[model samples]
Target: MSSLQFNAVLLEISNQLSAEQLEQIKFLCRDMIRKRELETIDTGRKLFNILTERGRLGADNKECLCELLREIQRHDLSDKLNRFESQSGSTDNQPDDEEKAKLDIATEVISENLGKSWRKLGRKLGLTDVKLESIYKRHPTELEEMAVELLKEWRKIRGAEARTEELIKALRACQYNLTADKVEHRLATR
Candidate 1:
Protein backbone atom coordinates (compact mmCIF):
# COMPACT_ATOMS: atom_id res chain seq x y z
CA MET A 1 0.00 0.00 0.00
CA SER A 2 1.04 3.57 -0.59
CA SER A 3 1.53 6.36 1.94
CA LEU A 4 -1.73 7.83 0.75
CA GLN A 5 -3.50 4.64 1.74
CA PHE A 6 -1.76 4.58 5.12
CA ASN A 7 -2.69 8.19 5.77
CA ALA A 8 -6.26 7.61 4.73
CA VAL A 9 -6.47 4.74 7.18
CA LEU A 10 -5.11 6.96 9.96
CA LEU A 11 -7.53 9.70 9.05
CA GLU A 12 -10.40 7.24 9.19
CA ILE A 13 -9.23 5.92 12.53
CA SER A 14 -8.83 9.44 13.86
CA ASN A 15 -12.29 10.33 12.70
CA GLN A 16 -13.71 7.43 14.67
CA LEU A 17 -12.07 8.52 17.92
CA SER A 18 -14.08 10.57 20.38
CA ALA A 19 -12.66 13.79 21.83
CA GLU A 20 -11.99 12.05 25.14
CA GLN A 21 -10.18 9.26 23.34
CA LEU A 22 -7.92 11.81 21.68
CA GLU A 23 -7.17 13.30 25.07
CA GLN A 24 -6.32 9.83 26.36
CA ILE A 25 -3.88 9.36 23.51
CA LYS A 26 -2.21 12.67 24.27
CA PHE A 27 -1.94 11.75 27.92
CA LEU A 28 -0.50 8.34 27.08
CA CYS A 29 2.12 9.91 24.85
CA ARG A 30 3.12 12.53 27.44
CA ASP A 31 6.63 11.11 27.67
CA MET A 32 7.32 11.45 23.95
CA ILE A 33 5.11 14.48 23.24
CA ARG A 34 5.51 17.56 25.40
CA LYS A 35 2.61 18.76 27.53
CA ARG A 36 2.67 22.18 25.95
CA GLU A 37 2.40 20.65 22.51
CA LEU A 38 -0.27 18.21 23.62
CA GLU A 39 -2.40 21.06 24.91
CA THR A 40 -2.62 22.48 21.40
CA ILE A 41 -3.59 19.20 19.78
CA ASP A 42 -7.38 19.16 19.62
CA THR A 43 -7.62 17.02 16.55
CA GLY A 44 -6.40 13.53 15.66
CA ARG A 45 -4.78 14.67 12.44
CA LYS A 46 -2.75 17.21 14.37
CA LEU A 47 -1.84 14.63 16.97
CA PHE A 48 -0.74 12.21 14.27
CA ASN A 49 1.22 15.01 12.65
CA ILE A 50 3.07 15.70 15.89
CA LEU A 51 3.71 12.00 16.33
CA THR A 52 5.06 11.86 12.81
CA GLU A 53 7.24 14.92 13.28
CA ARG A 54 8.59 13.56 16.56
CA GLY A 55 9.45 10.26 14.83
CA ARG A 56 6.81 8.34 16.73
CA LEU A 57 4.68 7.43 13.70
CA GLY A 58 5.60 6.34 10.19
CA ALA A 59 5.09 3.64 7.61
CA ASP A 60 7.98 1.65 9.07
CA ASN A 61 6.84 2.04 12.72
CA LYS A 62 3.22 1.79 13.82
CA GLU A 63 3.56 -0.07 17.10
CA CYS A 64 3.28 3.09 19.16
CA LEU A 65 0.01 4.03 17.52
CA CYS A 66 -1.34 0.53 17.88
CA GLU A 67 -0.30 0.40 21.52
CA LEU A 68 -1.95 3.74 22.15
CA LEU A 69 -5.16 2.39 20.66
CA ARG A 70 -5.01 -0.65 22.93
CA GLU A 71 -4.29 1.58 25.93
CA ILE A 72 -7.44 3.52 25.20
CA GLN A 73 -9.43 0.27 25.01
CA ARG A 74 -9.81 0.59 21.29
CA HIS A 75 -8.84 -2.88 20.19
CA ASP A 76 -10.87 -2.43 17.04
CA LEU A 77 -8.65 0.44 16.00
CA SER A 78 -5.55 -1.49 16.88
CA ASP A 79 -6.81 -4.35 14.77
CA LYS A 80 -7.43 -1.94 11.97
CA LEU A 81 -3.86 -0.73 12.21
CA ASN A 82 -2.60 -4.27 12.21
CA ARG A 83 -4.73 -5.06 9.19
CA PHE A 84 -3.23 -2.12 7.40
CA GLU A 85 0.24 -3.33 8.25
CA SER A 86 -0.56 -6.77 6.92
CA GLN A 87 -2.09 -5.36 3.77
CA SER A 88 0.94 -3.17 3.22
CA GLY A 89 3.29 -6.08 3.72
CA SER A 90 5.26 -4.07 6.26
CA THR A 91 7.41 -5.73 8.88
CA ASP A 92 6.08 -5.56 12.43
CA ASN A 93 8.32 -2.59 13.25
CA GLN A 94 11.39 -4.75 13.17
CA PRO A 95 14.58 -3.01 12.12
CA ASP A 96 16.62 -4.53 9.32
CA ASP A 97 19.92 -6.21 10.18
CA GLU A 98 22.01 -3.16 9.21
CA GLU A 99 19.85 -0.76 11.19
CA LYS A 100 19.98 -3.05 14.18
CA ALA A 101 23.78 -3.14 14.02
CA LYS A 102 23.95 0.63 13.77
CA LEU A 103 21.65 1.07 16.77
CA ASP A 104 23.72 -1.40 18.82
CA ILE A 105 26.96 0.40 18.00
CA ALA A 106 25.41 3.78 18.66
CA THR A 107 24.07 2.65 22.02
CA GLU A 108 27.51 1.37 23.08
CA VAL A 109 29.39 4.48 21.96
CA ILE A 110 26.91 6.88 23.55
CA SER A 111 26.73 4.97 26.83
CA GLU A 112 30.51 4.70 27.28
CA ASN A 113 31.41 8.24 26.16
CA LEU A 114 28.41 10.16 27.52
CA GLY A 115 30.21 10.82 30.85
CA LYS A 116 28.92 13.56 33.16
CA SER A 117 26.71 15.08 30.48
CA TRP A 118 24.20 12.23 30.37
CA ARG A 119 21.43 14.37 31.81
CA LYS A 120 21.97 17.03 29.17
CA LEU A 121 21.90 14.39 26.45
CA GLY A 122 18.72 12.95 27.91
CA ARG A 123 17.07 16.34 27.92
CA LYS A 124 18.17 16.89 24.35
CA LEU A 125 16.66 13.55 23.46
CA GLY A 126 13.30 14.75 24.86
CA LEU A 127 13.45 12.98 28.23
CA THR A 128 11.70 14.87 31.02
CA ASP A 129 13.63 16.37 33.94
CA VAL A 130 11.68 14.19 36.34
CA LYS A 131 12.65 11.12 34.37
CA LEU A 132 16.27 12.21 34.26
CA GLU A 133 16.34 12.77 38.03
CA SER A 134 14.83 9.34 38.55
CA ILE A 135 17.52 7.83 36.36
CA TYR A 136 20.26 9.77 38.13
CA LYS A 137 18.98 8.62 41.51
CA ARG A 138 18.96 5.04 40.30
CA HIS A 139 22.64 5.03 39.31
CA PRO A 140 23.81 7.82 41.62
CA THR A 141 27.60 7.91 41.10
CA GLU A 142 27.62 5.29 38.36
CA LEU A 143 27.54 7.62 35.36
CA GLU A 144 27.95 4.88 32.77
CA GLU A 145 25.08 2.88 34.19
CA MET A 146 23.03 6.05 34.33
CA ALA A 147 23.79 6.74 30.69
CA VAL A 148 22.88 3.20 29.68
CA GLU A 149 19.70 3.38 31.71
CA LEU A 150 18.86 6.72 30.21
CA LEU A 151 19.19 5.36 26.69
CA LYS A 152 17.20 2.29 27.63
CA GLU A 153 14.44 4.44 29.09
CA TRP A 154 14.39 6.50 25.94
CA ARG A 155 14.18 3.38 23.81
CA LYS A 156 11.40 1.99 25.96
CA ILE A 157 9.40 5.17 25.59
CA ARG A 158 10.09 5.50 21.87
CA GLY A 159 9.45 1.83 21.07
CA ALA A 160 10.36 0.95 17.50
CA GLU A 161 10.61 4.62 16.58
CA ALA A 162 13.94 4.94 18.33
CA ARG A 163 16.72 5.07 15.75
CA THR A 164 20.48 5.44 15.93
CA GLU A 165 20.24 8.55 13.77
CA GLU A 166 17.96 10.15 16.34
CA LEU A 167 20.43 9.36 19.12
CA ILE A 168 23.32 10.75 17.08
CA LYS A 169 21.31 13.88 16.38
CA ALA A 170 20.58 14.31 20.09
CA LEU A 171 24.28 13.85 20.88
CA ARG A 172 25.18 16.55 18.38
CA ALA A 173 22.49 18.86 19.71
CA CYS A 174 23.74 18.37 23.27
CA GLN A 175 27.27 19.24 22.02
CA TYR A 176 28.61 15.72 22.36
CA ASN A 177 30.03 15.93 18.87
CA LEU A 178 32.85 13.50 19.45
CA THR A 179 30.49 10.80 20.68
CA ALA A 180 28.16 11.37 17.77
CA ASP A 181 31.17 11.25 15.46
CA LYS A 182 32.22 7.98 16.99
CA VAL A 183 28.75 6.52 16.35
CA GLU A 184 28.83 7.74 12.78
CA HIS A 185 32.32 6.37 12.22
CA ARG A 186 31.40 3.01 13.71
CA LEU A 187 28.25 2.80 11.63
CA ALA A 188 30.18 3.75 8.53
CA THR A 189 32.89 1.16 9.08
CA ARG A 190 30.35 -1.56 9.74
Candidate 2:
Protein backbone atom coordinates (compact mmCIF):
# COMPACT_ATOMS: atom_id res chain seq x y z
CA MET A 1 0.00 0.00 0.00
CA SER A 2 1.00 3.64 -0.48
CA SER A 3 2.99 5.30 2.29
CA LEU A 4 0.39 8.07 2.51
CA GLN A 5 -2.46 5.59 3.01
CA PHE A 6 -0.42 3.68 5.58
CA ASN A 7 0.30 6.95 7.39
CA ALA A 8 -3.43 7.79 7.48
CA VAL A 9 -4.17 4.45 9.09
CA LEU A 10 -1.37 5.03 11.64
CA LEU A 11 -2.86 8.45 12.41
CA GLU A 12 -6.25 6.82 13.04
CA ILE A 13 -4.60 4.31 15.36
CA SER A 14 -2.70 7.14 17.13
CA ASN A 15 -5.99 8.91 18.02
CA GLN A 16 -6.84 5.92 20.25
CA LEU A 17 -3.51 5.53 22.12
CA SER A 18 -1.80 6.92 25.25
CA ALA A 19 1.57 8.80 25.35
CA GLU A 20 3.63 5.79 26.54
CA GLN A 21 1.91 3.46 24.09
CA LEU A 22 2.50 6.00 21.28
CA GLU A 23 6.23 6.04 22.12
CA GLN A 24 6.30 2.26 21.83
CA ILE A 25 4.59 2.44 18.41
CA LYS A 26 7.02 5.11 17.22
CA PHE A 27 10.01 3.01 18.31
CA LEU A 28 8.62 -0.04 16.47
CA CYS A 29 7.98 1.93 13.25
CA ARG A 30 11.46 3.45 13.32
CA ASP A 31 13.00 0.01 13.77
CA MET A 32 10.94 -1.37 10.87
CA ILE A 33 11.81 1.47 8.49
CA ARG A 34 15.52 1.27 9.41
CA LYS A 35 15.46 -2.46 8.61
CA ARG A 36 13.69 -1.73 5.28
CA GLU A 37 10.89 -4.09 6.35
CA LEU A 38 8.18 -1.46 6.94
CA GLU A 39 7.09 -1.25 3.27
CA THR A 40 5.54 -4.74 3.18
CA ILE A 41 1.89 -5.59 3.80
CA ASP A 42 3.03 -8.29 6.25
CA THR A 43 4.82 -5.62 8.32
CA GLY A 44 1.57 -3.66 8.60
CA ARG A 45 -0.22 -6.85 9.65
CA LYS A 46 2.44 -7.50 12.28
CA LEU A 47 2.09 -3.92 13.56
CA PHE A 48 -1.69 -4.29 13.81
CA ASN A 49 -1.27 -7.58 15.70
CA ILE A 50 1.15 -5.95 18.15
CA LEU A 51 -1.26 -3.05 18.78
CA THR A 52 -4.26 -5.38 19.24
CA GLU A 53 -2.37 -7.76 21.54
CA ARG A 54 -1.09 -4.89 23.72
CA GLY A 55 -4.48 -3.09 23.86
CA ARG A 56 -2.56 -0.03 22.57
CA LEU A 57 -5.07 0.86 19.82
CA GLY A 58 -8.08 0.93 22.16
CA ALA A 59 -9.81 4.02 23.72
CA ASP A 60 -7.42 4.14 26.69
CA ASN A 61 -4.36 4.50 24.39
CA LYS A 62 -5.61 7.46 22.25
CA GLU A 63 -3.07 10.10 23.31
CA CYS A 64 -0.05 7.79 23.01
CA LEU A 65 -1.21 6.68 19.55
CA CYS A 66 -1.35 10.27 18.29
CA GLU A 67 2.16 10.99 19.57
CA LEU A 68 3.48 7.86 17.83
CA LEU A 69 1.81 8.88 14.56
CA ARG A 70 3.50 12.31 14.70
CA GLU A 71 6.91 10.71 15.24
CA ILE A 72 6.42 8.37 12.28
CA GLN A 73 5.28 11.27 10.04
CA ARG A 74 8.32 13.32 11.05
CA HIS A 75 10.71 10.46 10.21
CA ASP A 76 8.99 9.89 6.84
CA LEU A 77 9.23 13.58 5.93
CA SER A 78 12.95 13.66 6.85
CA ASP A 79 13.64 10.65 4.60
CA LYS A 80 11.76 12.26 1.68
CA LEU A 81 13.70 15.53 2.06
CA ASN A 82 17.03 13.65 2.04
CA ARG A 83 16.07 11.74 -1.14
CA PHE A 84 14.99 14.93 -2.94
CA GLU A 85 18.27 16.69 -2.12
CA SER A 86 20.35 13.72 -3.29
CA GLN A 87 18.47 13.41 -6.63
CA SER A 88 18.87 17.11 -7.32
CA GLY A 89 22.70 16.76 -6.94
CA SER A 90 22.65 19.38 -4.18
CA THR A 91 24.11 16.81 -1.80
CA ASP A 92 27.18 16.08 -3.97
CA ASN A 93 29.95 18.23 -2.55
CA GLN A 94 32.73 17.17 -4.98
CA PRO A 95 33.12 17.34 -8.76
CA ASP A 96 33.62 13.98 -10.57
CA ASP A 97 37.40 13.65 -11.09
CA GLU A 98 37.20 11.56 -14.27
CA GLU A 99 34.85 14.03 -15.98
CA LYS A 100 37.07 16.96 -15.03
CA ALA A 101 40.12 15.14 -16.38
CA LYS A 102 38.43 14.54 -19.75
CA LEU A 103 37.45 18.20 -20.09
CA ASP A 104 40.94 19.33 -19.19
CA ILE A 105 42.43 16.97 -21.82
CA ALA A 106 40.08 18.27 -24.51
CA THR A 107 41.05 21.86 -23.73
CA GLU A 108 44.78 21.04 -23.82
CA VAL A 109 44.49 19.22 -27.17
CA ILE A 110 42.59 22.12 -28.71
CA SER A 111 45.20 24.58 -27.48
CA GLU A 112 48.15 22.46 -28.70
CA ASN A 113 46.75 21.86 -32.21
CA LEU A 114 45.84 25.51 -32.62
CA GLY A 115 49.61 26.31 -32.48
CA LYS A 116 49.46 28.24 -29.22
CA SER A 117 52.03 27.50 -26.47
CA TRP A 118 50.35 26.30 -23.29
CA ARG A 119 51.24 29.53 -21.46
CA LYS A 120 49.67 31.57 -24.25
CA LEU A 121 46.68 29.21 -24.49
CA GLY A 122 46.29 29.26 -20.70
CA ARG A 123 46.21 33.06 -20.74
CA LYS A 124 43.50 32.98 -23.42
CA LEU A 125 41.58 30.17 -21.62
CA GLY A 126 41.98 31.92 -18.23
CA LEU A 127 43.92 28.94 -16.81
CA THR A 128 47.56 28.40 -15.84
CA ASP A 129 49.95 26.49 -18.13
CA VAL A 130 50.66 24.07 -15.27
CA LYS A 131 46.96 23.35 -14.91
CA LEU A 132 46.67 22.70 -18.66
CA GLU A 133 49.66 20.34 -18.56
CA SER A 134 48.22 18.52 -15.57
CA ILE A 135 45.00 17.91 -17.46
CA TYR A 136 46.92 16.50 -20.47
CA LYS A 137 48.87 14.21 -18.16
CA ARG A 138 45.72 12.89 -16.50
CA HIS A 139 43.77 12.31 -19.73
CA PRO A 140 46.14 11.41 -22.63
CA THR A 141 43.21 11.02 -25.06
CA GLU A 142 43.74 14.70 -25.80
CA LEU A 143 46.83 13.70 -27.82
CA GLU A 144 44.63 12.32 -30.62
CA GLU A 145 43.37 15.76 -31.54
CA MET A 146 46.89 17.15 -31.37
CA ALA A 147 48.07 14.32 -33.65
CA VAL A 148 45.33 15.08 -36.18
CA GLU A 149 46.25 18.74 -36.19
CA LEU A 150 49.94 17.84 -36.62
CA LEU A 151 49.04 15.80 -39.72
CA LYS A 152 46.99 18.66 -41.16
CA GLU A 153 49.87 21.07 -40.62
CA TRP A 154 52.34 18.57 -42.17
CA ARG A 155 50.08 18.17 -45.23
CA LYS A 156 50.10 21.91 -45.77
CA ILE A 157 53.90 22.03 -45.51
CA ARG A 158 54.83 18.79 -47.43
CA GLY A 159 52.00 18.56 -49.99
CA ALA A 160 49.26 15.86 -50.11
CA GLU A 161 51.36 13.11 -51.81
CA ALA A 162 54.24 13.20 -49.30
CA ARG A 163 51.88 13.48 -46.33
CA THR A 164 49.84 10.43 -47.53
CA GLU A 165 53.03 8.35 -48.04
CA GLU A 166 54.35 9.31 -44.60
CA LEU A 167 51.02 8.41 -42.96
CA ILE A 168 51.04 4.96 -44.66
CA LYS A 169 54.54 4.25 -43.34
CA ALA A 170 53.56 5.47 -39.87
CA LEU A 171 50.51 3.18 -39.89
CA ARG A 172 52.61 0.18 -40.86
CA ALA A 173 55.21 0.94 -38.19
CA CYS A 174 52.70 1.21 -35.34
CA GLN A 175 55.53 1.94 -32.89
CA TYR A 176 56.58 5.01 -34.90
CA ASN A 177 53.12 6.65 -35.01
CA LEU A 178 50.86 7.66 -32.11
CA THR A 179 47.58 6.34 -33.58
CA ALA A 180 44.36 6.45 -31.55
CA ASP A 181 43.93 2.65 -31.25
CA LYS A 182 47.52 2.08 -30.14
CA VAL A 183 47.36 4.96 -27.66
CA GLU A 184 44.02 3.77 -26.23
CA HIS A 185 45.28 0.20 -25.87
CA ARG A 186 48.47 1.40 -24.17
CA LEU A 187 46.48 3.54 -21.75
CA ALA A 188 44.02 0.72 -20.96
CA THR A 189 46.81 -1.82 -20.30
CA ARG A 190 48.66 0.66 -18.10
Candidate 1: stretches off by over 4 Å: 1-97
Residue-wise C-alpha lDDT for candidate 1, range 1-190, written one tens digit per residue: 6789889989988887899999999999899988899899999999999999989898778899999998987776776677666645644454567666777788888888989989898888887776687577668999889998888767655655778989988888888899999989988887
Candidate 1 colliding pairs:
none
Model 2, span 18-134: residue lDDT tens: 455444554666643433433332443456555545565432343444445446543322222333333333334333565334323433333344332323323332333333443
**lDDT accuracy of residue 4 in candidate 1:** 90
Query: TM-score of every model?
Result: 0.50, 0.20
Best by lDDT: 1
lDDT of 2 at 62: 35
Question: For each candidate, C-alpha RMSD in Å?
Answer: 13.4, 22.4
